[model samples]
Target: MTYWAAIARKSFQGGSTVEVPLPSSPKLIGASLLPPKHDPFYSQLFELEIQRHTTIAKRFDFHGSMIDQLMALVSSKSNVKNPTRVEVVTALLNRCIVNAAKKNNDPLRPFILFMPFTIQNLLNPLLPHKLVENYLTFFLVPIPDEGDLEIPTLVSNIQKEKINYFRKYKGININQTISTISNDTEDFKQNNLANTRLTTSLCGYQFYDMDFGFGKPEKVSIGAMLIKYSMVLFDSPCKGGIDVVITLEEEVMPNFEIDEELNTFTSLDPSY
Candidate 1:
């Protein structure tokens, strides 16, 4: 294993970044997925340790100065698997809880949650009740009023987990009130999936256009880039809502990084 691969495989619990060599082969015989994500096993135990120590790291508050640099160095650039803090946390919660559900085969278990803007406020009145379970609760990265958050491990973890688990499991009984994207109606045929209530709340205007302070944008749009190379999104509220979280790498946020070389490759369409 190369140095980067070895570093990525090692648990990254605390740092902002870790340099990792790209993996030579697709298969990681024994490497970890990625680090700085709340390791489910580690988190469950650490929650107790922090409580025991009674020093500083409080529940849901681990980013303080109390954690050492070595602990923080876990977030690495591992394209071989999940490579960001957000990706790792989402994967852990998704895997451990979904694995538990699949083990028991629950009839109404939800592996991937869809908190679409069309259905954000539609969670059941008892929805608060579901969050108490380890599998159910998901953290929401608080975007500033302008719409962007810094740390991303918690929500990113859920997205990775949902995508992987549902992609593998063929079908799931989801109670949803979808306002759009109606292509997959077959999954809930005869079932009351449609009856599952959903609601949404929209806020703010698409202000990325008027760049009052940031200066004229070389490019701008609704922001969707899924290619292998660099991924650029200038918009706010990236994935589901208005919050976009990516690694602190130029490969992920090109404009934010501002490299003159890659600037030549940019193509712009205002209508987009």
Candidate 2:
């Protein structure tokens, strides 16, 4: 059986989060660790805080009118000296955005954005042809003090490393080789619990959109059928809010097996 080779990756970029899900696989990993919530806006209102406690640079950007409105709540802290905490970091980015927004009066300071679910370019499978077993995508919020790079640039930076791993693995002759995600934090512990089944939470149409009732869907989410796996932030107009679908591989699968019964049925009626 050709099975998906799964692994975990994480970022202490700002918030605390441990991710599990190798890139070769069709979806993102689980969130075992979450960073401390700095903005009352993100956690207080939305009930979720994304990782990115501190970056080596100055600012990170979030897009769409939905994300923009949420950004407005994190007040600027450009001038705070000796800042190390996630909440403190929030101010610095906000300050930069405010000044940039006011200087050119551009309400939205566009950041490098990539919609991973849009695989139009990947129809031919742009990924390395080893049938990528598993992988994870980390949301990198570079320091505000740094210059901006487009989504393609960011994707290139990440893929370059993993593809190299796949190359070396085949060079040595392995059954579906794998890439080792750097152990930045302690969150990427190996969980080898095979016989685990996948479910909708890890694969398909989830609960993040039932309330919209056909109103442009709030955001166009990709599904598991054609897309296999997908994840995108569901931004809200209300302050201190952002929803993330950090799907863990194992959690979703086992449920699916149980729900479907794995094509197994005990013969209560015996044929003579």
Candidate 3:
């Protein structure tokens, strides 16, 4: 998988085959002769079943007009300058999810967002070849108690957390930072219980442009392997818009879907 991924990355960057290093040993592993002990159909069947039993995923669309309104709101109301679409959307989702938990008679706990950051741009002069492994780091944004805070305020707070983390780890070695964050993340999870949520943005990744010899994909989905209390944001087919796939406890989904503030800007289960 890593070998193929490396090749794909090189191809995406218009690099030649010579740029990628060959594997040291060439060994072929054949399929097992015996029947599988468990379900052998879907690789993630167990994981998906667990997710299905514990959570539900809801898809929502935020149109261009909605995004514009959010941008304007962030600009006029918050101290965060030029807030990106991802930031605003994340803030809104976080707020709505927390509100849903509150309405569901669940305790309002602080949120810890696991946001992914690419390190390719941060490298000096850049690497001669892309690394096969993930060149990504997670930004842990510890959200304060939502209370009655508005979207703009939440956006500003999220940005502040990101900026602080970046500045603190700016000159540190990437490997060291990753190790430290791993320890910190484990501690946070142990201490926070059901408070932490993972939020990832694949918006600007141009996933729609990929061609697997079947032409461009009409739509892309993350499928059923989702973490509970997590949200994944993607760029909508239409420009200046976003598609959010959020997973929450099945019981809390109803309240989240009908959230007045969220409904003001999002179209639930929207068809293209």
Task: List the global CA lDDT of all models.
Answer: 0.28, 0.26, 0.69
| Predicted candidate 2 versus true structure: per-residue lDDT over 24-48, tens digit per residue | 4332221211112243321321222
Better of 2 and 3 by lDDT: 3
Error of 2 at 265 (Å): 51
Give the Cα-based TM-score of candidate 2 against the true structure: 0.20
Candidates 1 and 3 compared: the better one by lDDT is 3
User: How many clashes in each structure?
Assistant: 14, 37, 0
Cα lDDT tens digits, model 1, 67-116, are: 22212432432222333332332222222222332334533332222222
Error of 3 at 44 (Å): 17
Off by over 4 Å in 3: 1-53, 171-190, 270-272
Instruction: Rank candidates by lDDT, best first.
Output: 3, 1, 2
How many collisions between residues are there in candidate 1? 14
lDDT of 3 at 272: 24
lDDT of 3 at 137: 57
